[model samples]
Target chain A: MNPTKPTDDARKGDVVSPTKDKGWFYTDTVKDHFFHPRNFMQDESAYGEAAMGMVGSPACGDAMKIWIKVDPATGRISDMKWKTFGCGSAIASTSMMSVMVTENGGMTLEDARKLRPQNIMERLGGLPARKVHCSVLGDKALRAAINDWYRRAGQHDNIEIEQGRVIDATLKITDKDIEEAVLDGADTLEKVQAKTKVGTGDPSCIPEVENLIRFYKEKYFGAE
Target chain B: MRDIYLDNAATTALEPRVLDAMLPYFTERPANPSSFHSMGLRAKEAVAAARGTVAGILNSREDEVLFTSGGTESDNLAVVGIPRAYVAKGRHVITSAIEHPAVLEPLLHLQKKSEIELTVLPVDRFGMVDPAAVVAALRPETVFVSIMYANNEIGTIQPIAEIGKEILKWRKEHATPLPYFHSDACQASGACPLDVEKLHVDAMSVNGSKIYGPKGVGILYLRRGVALDPLVRGGGQERGIRAGTENVPGIVGLATALSLARQEMEKENARLIALRDRLIAGLLAIPKTRLNGHPTVRLPNNVNISFLDIEGEAAVLYLDAEGIYVSTGSACASTSLDPSHVILATGLSYEGAHGSLRFTLGKHTTADDIERVIAVMPGVVQKLRVMSPVNLDMKYFA
Candidate 1:
C-alpha cells in the first residue's frame, strides 16, 4: 500500500492512498455508482413532485441536487433522482440513496430522516477520511428533497426549522465606486458615510463601506 | 500504478543521503544540544557544524541563521519581528501582490496591531514585480519591503537585487534608516543560488522540505544589524528569536539536504529547465491553451498553463485517475474552490484562474515524466472540456 511502488491489483480510479495498508481505508466501491449512476433523472410529470438544488456549504465543499416524486395514493415515494456536483463519494452516495428508496418501496418522512452517511459508506465499502462528509450530503439532500415534497403537498405544519440571522443589505457599490469615494475625501468611516450616497438595500454597498472603514481604521484611527 | 509527483513547491521526497545523515542524531546520540554534559556537548557540536554547512551555501555567518518550524513560521518571525521592533522608526511595509501567503498573511496580521500601512504592489501578466513600482510606492513611514525571491505558483523570479538597489538609493537620499527587506526564498533555495550579501536583504526565510529534507525545519537568515522582536518565549533556543527544544533530526536532515542541493544545483537546474520547456511546449501544442507565467524569467522547474473551457479540478481528477499527480494551483490553498491569488494577480479572469494548473518539476522529475504528462494531458483536457459548462469554441484568453 506504500504509494512509491505500484500495486499488482491497482485498477482504474482505485486510490491506494497513505492509509491504504490499514484495512480500515476505503476501496473502489465508487465505480459501481460512477459507471452506472442509478436514478439519474427525475419523473418530470409526476404528482406531488419537488426539487431542491443546494450548492456549497462550510461542511461539504461542493453542490448537489435532489428530486422526489410522492405517490398520493400510498403517501410514499413514487420516484427520486439526484445529480451531484461534487466528489466521487457524493455521486456514489446519491446513487445508493436511489437504490435504498427503491428497496424501501418509497420513503416515509421518518425513514428519510433515518438515512445517514455511515449507511451509505458501509454499502460503498467506506469513504476516504476527507470525503466522509461528501456522502453525508446525499442523506441531507434526500431529507431536504422529501421535505420539499411534503411542503408541495401542503404538509408544512409537520416540520420545524429555525431561521438564520438577517441584516441590512446594500446595492450598486463596486470597488471602483469605493475608490472614487475615497478620492473625494472619504478617508474615515464618518467621511465615507457622509460622502457616498449608499443606502442599506443593495448587497454590494455595505461590504464596500465596511472595507473602507476597515482600511481607514488601520491607517488613521481605530475600528468600530 | 505509480503516480508521478509534480508538486515540488508543496513539498519534496526526503533525499536518502540526508535521511542517512540524520539517523544517528535521532537514535544513537540523542541528547539536548542546550545541556553542558558530554552527550550535550557532542549534540551542540553537531548543530554548530550543521549551521556552518547551511551558512556556506548562503555565504553568510553561522550566527545569522535561526531555525524555526518551517517557512511560514520563519516568514512570520521576519515580517512581524522586524516591523514590531522598529515601529518607532516607521510603520509602513511594502510587498508584492504575487507573494506566497507565508509573507502576506503575517503582514496582514501586523496591520491589526499598529498604525501600519501595507502596500501590495501589483504585477504584470507574467507575475514579476517591477523594482521601479516598489520605489514609487514607498512612503516616509515604510519600514520594510518583503518580496519573494521567486514565485511558487507561476515561478516568476522577482528582480531582488534591482529592488535592493532602489531601496538603498531611497534610504541614502532621504537620510533615513533603511527599510529592512525580507525575501521568502523557500521555493528558490535549491532552484536558485541563495547569496544573502549579493541580494542585499536584511532577512530571508528558507525551508528544508523544499530542498529534500524533512518538513518541520527551516531557517530565518537575519543579517547582523537587523533587530527583531522574539516571537516565542521560554527555553531561549534559536538565539531567543524562536524558543523551543531543537528538532535535532530535522535540523541535521536540513543541513545535509542543503549542502547536497547546493552542490548539485547547476546540473539539476539545467535538467529541470529542459523538462519544463518540454512540458510547456507539449501543453501549448493543444488548441486554446495559454501559458500563465513568464516564458524565460520563470523558475526552471515550474510550468503553469490554463486550458480554455476546462475545469481545473476535473482535469486534475482525470490526471489522478491516470496515476499522474499535478495541482490546480498552490497546493496549500487549493482546498478552497476560489482560484489562487497568485493566478488572479496576473490579471487572469476568474474563469482563466479556475482553468489553470501548475506542474512543478523537481530533482526526481525526468524527461520520461514530462513525456508521460505530454501523452496524457491533451486527452484529459479534451474530455473535461467536452463535459464543462463553457463551450471550447469561445476564445477566452486575453
Candidate 2:
C-alpha cells in the first residue's frame, strides 16, 4: 500500500489530528488500537496478583511490562494488563496482544505462548516497517509472564525458555541480547557492538551478529 | 479546537504580506525573465529588485546573491560546489558535526568519493562549536568550512563572527587564500542578525520558508572572487553558479519576507524570547524534565525539552490531539527509528534523545498559545508517564 496517501478508513475520523495523513502510514487496525488501546493498565499497582513480565529498558527509549492473571484450573489467561514506555506502535502492540489473549473467554497459556509478534502484527493489519520490533515486545513479555507464572506455581519443568546464544565462548552474548540492543535504538552494527560486544571476542560470530542485526531490523522495521 | 502551532522551526505559515507580494508574479507578471519582451523585462526587473532587497539584509552586493530552491540546494551548492571549484588549490574541508544533513550529506558524499579530506569538529555539550577547534582543524589543503549559524533541532547559535575572525587571522598568517568560510543561516534568518560583512563569512545560505515566505526558494551569498562550480548547468542563470529558470514568484516572496524579517527582527525577537522563556520555564518545571541546548545563547523562538520515561513521539501525538502542534526526535513519524543525531552529539543518551520535544515559536504565536501549551503539556505528560513501563526509580526486571 502507498503509506503516504490516506486510505478511506484512515479519513473516517479514527484519527483525531488535523493533519489528515499523520497516521496514514499506519493501518486502520493499528490506528484504532493506538487511539483506543485495550487492556492498558492505567494504574500499575492495581494488578498486584498478576504475573508480570518486562522487556526493553527506559535507557533505550522503549520498555514494556505485561501483567497476566492465569486461571489455575484451565491454564488460561483470564485477564491481561500492560504498561509500555515507547512509541504508538509499542503501546498498540501490547494493547492488541492483551485483548487477543483475553477475548473469547481467554486463551490457554500454551496458546498464548504460541502467539508470535507476526501474529499480533497480522491482527493489527500490519505495522510500519520500523515498528515491527515494537510488536516483538508483546510476545516476548507474554512468554516471560507465562514463565513467571510457572515459576510462582512451582512448575519448574513446565517453564519453557528459548535459549539464543550468538557467541560460543565464555562471553555470553545471545541473539535476545542483540534484539534488546536493537530495541534500545541500536540500529547499526557498531552501535550493537558497543551495547552487547557480541562479536568483539569471537571473530567467527561477527558475520552471524551482522546477519542477526539484519534479521531483527527487517523483522521489526522492514517493509511488509 | 483552538490550534496553537509551535513547530515553526519545521515550517511556518506564509505571511499574508509575503503572499500578496508574490501573487502578482504568479498571476499577472507570468513572463519568462529570459525573454526580451517588455513583460519579461518587468519580470527580470522584479527579480533584480528582490535580489537587492536580500543583499541589503545581508549587507552584501546585490550581484553576490544566487537564488536556488531553498536551504538544501543552497547548502549543496556551497559544500559540493566550492570543493569542485577549488580542488586544485586544496581538497581538505572542515565542518561541524551538528550541521543539517543538507550540509553534512553532500560533504559525506565528497568524502565517500575520496574527493576531499573531511574533518568534522565536535560541538560542546551546549551544541556550540569552538572557534579554536575550527582554527586547529585548518590545514594548507583545507578549502572550505561550512558551519550553521544556529542549530535547527537544539537552537544553539554558533559564534560565526568569532570563528570567521579566527579563520581570517589564520589565512593572513599563512599568506594563503585556501579555506573559505560558509554558514547555513536558514534557521537564523529572522531570529539572529546575519551581516555577512560583520560576520566576515565568504558564503552564507538562507531560505524563504523559515522566515514566513514561500517555500522552494533560497539565497546563497557568495562573496566576490569566491568561485564555486555550478551544481545545475543550464542557461547561465545565478551567475553560472546555479543555472535554472528563476522562480520569480518565490524570489519576490523570499525578498519581501527577508526584508520584513530584517526590519522587524529586534521587536519580534524580544517578543519571541519572552514567550520562549515562559514556555521553557513552564516545561522545565515538570519533574525530571531537562531543557536541551544552550539555556540562553539559543534561538529566541526555540524550546527543546526532554521528559524522562515518556516517548517524545507519543507526547507529540497527544499534544497534536490537544490542538497544540509540536515535533519530536522521531524521523518524520516514519519507519526510520533512529534517535536524533543532534541531541545525541550533546552527550545525551539514546533514550533522552528519543524522548526530546521541540517547540519553535513564530510571528503569529501569542502569549496565550504559550500558556495553552504550558497548561496542556503537564497533563499529557502525566498521562503518558502513567502508561510508561519505565519505573521512575530506573529498575526493570522480568
Top candidate (lDDT): 2
lDDT of 2 at A84: 89
- lDDT (C-alpha, whole model) for all candidates: 0.72, 0.83
Give the runs in model 1 whose Cα sits over 4 Å from its true position.
A1-224, B330-335, B392-395
How do the residues A148-219 of candidate 1 rate in per-residue lDDT, one tens digit apiece? 766777888855331221112222233433443454345654444432333222334466467655664454
TM-scores, all candidates, are 0.73, 0.88
Lowest summed lDDT over 10 consecutive residues: which window, candidate 1 chain B?
Answer: B330-339
Residue pair clashes in candidate 2 = A129-A221, A132-A220, A133-A220
Report the error of model 2 at residue B45, Å: 0.8
Candidate 1 docking band: incorrect
Top candidate on TM-score is 2
Question: On residues B1-398, what C-alpha lDDT tens digit does candidate 1 reach at each position?
Answer: 55799988778999999999999998899999999999998999998888998888889999999888988999989888998898898898999998888888888877766557789999998998999999998888888999999998899999888888888889889998669889999989888878888887889999889879999899999999889998899898988878998888888889999889888989988888999999999999998888998999989989999876655655666677787878876211233334688988988765566667889888888788899999999987765443322443434467
- Using DockQ as the measure, which candidate wins? 2
